[model samples]
Target: MYQMLVDLTKPKTIRGHVDVVERSDAGTVTSKGKKKKRSRKKNGRTSSGVGSDEKLNQGVDESVDGCTIGKLFVSNRVIAMGSNGTIVFEGTYDGCRVAVKRLVKAVAFEVNLNLRISDNHPNIVRLYGTESDQNFWYLALERCTCSLNDLIQRPTVSEDQAKEVKVPKVMLWTDKGYPSTILVELMRDVVSGLVHLHGLGMFNQDLKPQNVLIFKEGPLRAKLSDLGISKRLVEDKSSLGDHATGKFSIPIPIQIVYCFNPIAQYLISLAVTGCGSSGWQAPLLNELQMRAVDMFSLGCVLFYCMTGGGHPLGDRLECDNNIVKQSKVDLFVVEHIPEAVDLLSCLFNTVAELRPKASEVLNHPLFWDSDTRLWFLHDVSDRLKLEERKANSDILKALESVSSLAFGTKWNRKMGRAFLKHIGKYRQYNYDSVHDLVRVVRNQLNHYSELPLEIQKILGPGNEGFDGYFRSRYPKLLMEVYKVMHQFCREEERLNKYFKGSVV
Candidate 1:
């Protein structure tokens, strides 16, 4: 329901001709034809930045296309600006649509460059190349639909406005938008990207919804885009042995240090910008380790997505930084799932040390179900080949999606309660009897479509509507159920053949 005012058909307002400068092959900023000294600022703002002198015009070729120079044809269409005064322009390079991020100050160029180089994941923005002017640095990246914050914060369309359009659930907002399934997928994408980043030796000091971009393609995919305020971890000498292949280990050990690298220190001191908004920023930001800070921000994001775009720390978070530190996340939704509440509890824990690591979170049962466990595989092991790792992760994700669709969490809970009713009656059965019972249940489920009317009548009543709804979706549901039961049969067969009465 969030509407962004992006008119691709409408002519964009082009700013007038501006001088284009190039960067040296060594990556040094140069102005026109001379070596220019880059001015450093605590906040990323330079006096002579790009588009500083000109107003919006219809015709003005900046002529930013050269070798070590710019190669993008920047259009007048303006994307959202960053909190730090960075302007993103919709541009093109070699006929490929791209987003060009223009920064006033080149102070964080090296920092941004390092972070971009280290980042290479599907759920993170892809940086193609970079260009610079006398007072600005432009980063060419893959263009996305909009930032997560923009999408969530957009004004919901009035009922009158949407009277003609048939908006799908994926496109819905207000009281009927962004269900748990979509939220889980978004969370997984973001977490997967963060895990990849954390695997590298860097931490995103600025992890907020504004920094998370949304690609509105087949299904909504979210990507972590900005890393200007990120900090790279300086490896400790003692941890060398843990780096088996000399590659940085994931969930890397980091400690709270008083002094950060020059770039990160500069980012931390900014009053109005850098890092993240107060509510999303972790308490004792500088005192806790980098991962802890990121986890806190992730927690905030999770809270936002789960509650239909509400902030965890409340709207008053902007009034004082102390409020974020003291505020508790109270998930008050009456029908909220306990698993989601448990996840939030871990994220909002006051003690930073007690927070769960990114890897631990991906393996959370909330992300897996019986249907998911059959079709896909979870990658709990990091000791596999690159291709193998990716394969397993993709498979797991596919399985997870199948689970979300076929036996979504809501139905799973309902069915679980219904099954629990027979537990008391079956409690007296032995292991062998229990096995037979499971087989009989599987057989009945397999032929659910063919059950007699009288037999169906005795099956119970609390979920008659639910049962009918699922039966309507019978083919798809039954296919998934059969696939799951097939896996169970295979496992049982293997166990019976090898370990049937034998002690391991």
Candidate 2:
């Protein structure tokens, strides 16, 4: 959807003439005239800070065709541009299409980080090789179709326009925007990438829609790109560790190296003065620990995707102000998807410590199918039946809070007296307590098929019948129940059991 406005004719030359170098096995670049030894300290400092244990290789092996600098080519067509004037151009390497990023008068910090972790997962953009001339540094990376920003911000096509555009089948688009299933899958891809990065002791400090790239080669895949402002957590173990554990009283100062480009200068300013881009930044950006910052930004990104480019905390100009004041989010857009609303509430919670981890997010009920969600609801009802006596427990307290807030109240009335009377013969139904609410839902789901034809039509049919009805009528009931149940279950085991074949 991103407009490629640059002229296709007269492809601009990157460099008229230059000596091509090949990286030999000795950690040095050899040209036709001379051999230059690449500085290990410089490359290491570019990513991991001065004297850090994470060492970066000068270049990848020349044996791989993709890594050979001589086989790379750059065109004039621009793919995208950074805030600091870094230009990404459509290019090729070893006869394979790639994206060539040109940085003027600046070091390639992003490239250093990408080379270190690119091969670890499919959700991360790959780095083919790096090349430099007198004026600019070039990084060849995996080419993606477009960014998440472009995809979500695409204007809704009219009926006639829709007929003309040959959209991919995997992208399920409708007048109301993408379906919940497709949005969940895209968010899962992103969260998986975040989990991988967090496991490696890294934080993508700037995580907005623009940085999330979408690959449409097979199934639609979302990959995390643009690590220009990302931070390595192991750099200052004591400072960052203390911050992570809530020991630091003030925001830690970010270290900045001098760079000539305006883009790098702008990035340095953000690093030294703030967390990330304004609208997508976390509320407690200065105080929250490493991954929490990313999770909050991810919450904003998720909201953007689900709402067809609407921000939860108002528009771009007002978002930062709203976040600073802890203003109530405008969640009406996703009120129809209770599970999504619940997950977003946690991710957007004002208390940074309460936000779910990346791995836990993937395990949320939002990613579960209709059948899995129904099963989960049934399981929660069974557990609540046993634990109802432990009123002081956290799970019960959560349920009580949800009940007091009027979530799923008088459920039998909503089902009509006839439907209630039919199930009333089996057992007594009281909708006053949270336990009763769960029981009512569980009983209704259990006797779905046996219900009268009129009631069956009201509840719909097949697997999603009850779920669709309940989610539309009482948007918070099932999700609140899920939160209560999630607290009681072991996350690792639950994930292995329920999400075995699912999208997490």
Candidate 3:
């Protein structure tokens, strides 16, 4: 994607800067010099519109040859049509896939360029350049496979109608949920983008699921696009008061309204009236309070992720009625992952001032291990290296299997509580305690065949078939347990070895 943007921005020739002319009201066509002739292509229509081909045309103030409004990019197909009558075409520029947005309003070009031209972040969509013809303004943007909203609804939706339809089944808890790691990474991307935007004193007033694009070509990269409703915060009275500076009046469609909470609806009304989505808008939206607005929107996003596309406030009709009668949002009760529910509580604090900043949210225990160390900071490389070292070692493999099977006893309803109580002593430990726990666990595994009756029930009545299956899989699980314990012990050793008092 970056390579495509570079290609779009590259200077094609050494010609002097050309004066950009609005062809419809054109008067003068200047040349670089008397020696080089300047002429417009007659009767030739470029992909955008019928116009004279000025090969060395200027984009903004800079001269970029081989990039004419009509000939620079070739349109393949119309990928999507925005609710505001805008159209997006899948186009190719210099062999790179690009999404060319045919904006209905000319202001869109300025809106996009203002927020994204100098800003470059993986989590934020990249804008290549802008152009205009007689009817529409064309923007060259990075092509994304689909929107986050679409990806979330894909499992239950049919491909034929998937592009244009909504599926409620996506919100069902019984469905196969997205991996926890992916959800965490997606949230990280949103926070990272918000960190950059807020640092520059700007806020995306309308941050919603549809505005978040998903790039599936490589990683499941979530980028915040569509900055038409974003605004810059300055030191002034206008910043403090809500005077509708950066409100998007695009009416929220019935099928796509995710945020129907009363507070969100009220704020949306204050900014813009007449049928529009307010799902991502801050509860008490003060344009001056930039970071808080973004944090509130992020909280809504996190809630959606955690609940598998369930709206934080409620369904559309419920939110509409709740707005008139209800004072508080009925938060979803997450049974499987209470940690995520706790984080969401902080994010959705009624007092916007009390909400945690994006950086603070990133550091929350929701992203950390049982020991409070962040999962992303773990030395995965070391783990990979350790696994490679013991790949061919039979003794290590056997030990790993034994440990895993021993832990498997917890899956049984009858023995699970006993297993929990037994492991409680080893859950938190000092260097000496860790060593002792490892020794105890290792010794306990030595008598694996004569396991307690409670655990043996889960492994199935002792039989040749059951024994064979358990023997085949237990070593791998045991190895995983050993590696985790060993890593924790080694980390403590390193801390004590290098910094004498650090171990405490």
Assess every candidate by TM-score.
Answer: 0.56, 0.67, 0.56
Per-residue C-alpha lDDT of model 3 across residues 1-504, encoded as one tens digit per residue: 767554544423213221211111111223332122333222233222223232223221111112345333423345677756777764433323456677766466446544454247888877665656666667767666567777676765686555443222223232223234565667667777776776666677677788887665344667887776566667522333335463434366621342655444564454553222455555544343556767767877777766657776777656544433423655644533434655677776766667776766665544432222211113222333354466574433443444423334432222245543553544542222222223333433444476666554544543422332332333223223333444443355422222221111
Leading candidate by lDDT: 2
Q: Give the whole-model CA lDDT for all candidates, comma-separated.
A: 0.49, 0.61, 0.49
lDDT of 3 at 181: 50
Off by over 4 Å in 2: 1-69, 156-179, 235-275, 283-288, 323-336, 350-354, 384-408, 416-428, 431-461, 486-504
Best by TM-score: 2
lDDT of 1 at 466: 25
Q: Candidate 2: lDDT over CA atoms?
A: 0.61
Q: Tens-digit lDDT track for model 1 on 340-436?
A: 5656678667877677767666654344433342222111111112324464554333334455444444342433433434433434322222122
Error of 3 at 235 (Å): 4.1
* lDDT per residue (tens digit) for residues 364-456 in model 2: 776776787777767677766656677477777777777744364566656666666776788876666676767766877888867789888
Candidate 1 scores a C-alpha RMSD against the true structure in Å of 15.4
Worst 10 residues of 1 by lDDT: 376-385
